[model samples]
Target: MAEQGAPQRRPSIHDVASHAGVSAATVSKVMQGVATVKPANVQRVFDAVERLGYRMDPLASELRRSKRRIIGAVVPEFESEFFGTVITELERLAEQRGYALVAASSRESEAREKEILARMHDWRVSGVVLAPVRNERSPAAAFMKASGMTGVMIDRVLADNAFDTISADSAAASAEVARALVGNGHRHVLVIGLGEQAATVHARLEGFRAQALALAPDMRIDVILSESDVAPLRASLRDYFGKGERPTAVYSLFLKGTLVALSEFRRRGWHCPNDISLVGFDDAEWMQVTFPAIAAVVQPVRRIATQAMDLLFRRIGGEEGPSRALLEPCKVLMRESVGSPGGGARAGGGDGQ
Candidate 1:
């Protein structure tokens, strides 16, 4: 019998083994799920564990295994609605798989993105999901090659096919937007984009331009590809609106781009459809709640997140095959913001202040 006023010692594997009347090795084999252990011994070990309240140390067990159940993810930025949703979905999926997920944001810096990849490699993560800042020869690909890191590229895709990639069908979706604008008699169109160097944005620009001109040979399409900074975006939008031949319809290729254009147009007292029709790439919540309810495209972020983690786990599990570049289609939600060009309103021109 234990003495009163004495400290209680935590139950250990040895205690469980003693309670089960088996060797410590047998207890460990049973706990680790080794199939060679006898059925009777397995039952005894479970019963002893329940009685002694002996729980295996997860960290110690991970150390004993060759691969740690840890996944790392790096994105260009966390503030964006798209990336934020992806991260949240990935965390939930990883937890369901009995793995811990670590997330990092690069703030849209190529150097910072590479640094995060290096740190993830150093940590010996089981796998990584990387949304690189640069689409052209991403430094992440080179770093992964040198470090022998296993990962899947998300959002921005590389041309070299160096790794498995998952992204929305940006070109198709952007082309659909152009088709809608041209169908509505919008010959004069404006496209607001960000980071022309990015693969996703570049694809959108080309897709819109190609489709608009193909549908209407004489369409006048003006494109403004600005930096991510709001100052540059606002300056370009103001300059365009202040000049001659105001666009009848505008297609914004990014969420922030859409917001900035809407704000600038409102500040200039220009109303939607009556003055200008608008469409955007991301279907943000406010887009739905606005007075006119802006038309926009909805990216399949949940599917992208799940597929990326699935491919990453396959690689971690030693599956060998040619890397796949999968493109998921986006859904376009057209609201009241898109309409035919106004007859007399189109001719009404001012300083657009």
Candidate 2:
């Protein structure tokens, strides 16, 4: 046959039941360890499952268990400094408040994030803290509609106002960065960004553009947006920078964008702050050690995380009212990499050097 040697797809629960000469419902009961099932039938179900390499999804099993004092947290990823820091603080604070934290990585996949949310629901966690994947109506909304688990959002702001949210004011920070650069004599700027579906990224971009245009009526603020593909990101950056007309400074809206843009600059033998001024929305550890340590508008991760947990606790304690959001202030950490749009740092704006 043309398909010879191709592996057969793994068996499903139905297939396992058919192979064991039992009904799907019976197999499900056996898998759930129902003592009422005949012992022989239980053995047959297990044998069939093992032979077919069939395994139960943890959610299915979790559905049968009693609830726990667990709080679930879902983040896009930790490559960015803010998310990793927020999760660490959330877990630490959760422990102090006598709760357990279960963390999941969405890897920036909306579908995967939804599956994780469903799993959390099935496991009957007392509450959840979410840094939702960006979408018009992300799984966060679906989760709210389909489950009773109380969720408090952090980092990314969801469009829906049906849930409590805690986050540093990303828009304010972006505006501040724009002001700093304009004050340092920069006329034109470029924003390199991804997280196209994310609400927080959108807010930051809006703020930056609004402030840049307002500050200098003649300034040009160029934007480059893409999905989370690294190859396309590199190619796009190369294409933009390869052009004759370049923005005076570059602002990276996402951490991935920041790291990728830095690599591209290095590949082109361009030095930051010397060739182009730079800043990011989030500060990373390596930024502190970079040749011309990069400037960033930094979030207060610990405070945001703690506040999110507080909101979750309030919801869990049956506090009922219209959902609200708490926006904290963010500050620009001016460093060597952000100075004059043309060459070097400002007279006294430099950090360290």
All candidates: TM-score: 0.81, 0.78
TM-score of 1: 0.81
Give me the runs in candidate 2 sitting further than 4 Å from their true place.
1-66, 350-353
The C-alpha lDDT values of all candidates are: 0.82, 0.77
C-alpha lDDT (0 to 100) for residue 64 of candidate 1: 80
* Model 2 pairs whose backbones collide: none
lDDT tens string, model 2, 196-299?
76788788999888898899888888888887766787788889889865677889997778888888778878787878888987888898898888887777
Instruction: For candidate 2, give the lDDT of residue 244.
Output: 67
Which residue runs does candidate 1 get wrong by more than 4 Å? 1-57, 158-160, 343-353
TM-score of 2: 0.78
Q: Which ten residues in a row have the lowest lDDT in candidate 1?
A: 344-353
Best by lDDT: 1
Query: Residue 130's C-alpha lDDT in candidate 2?
Result: 82
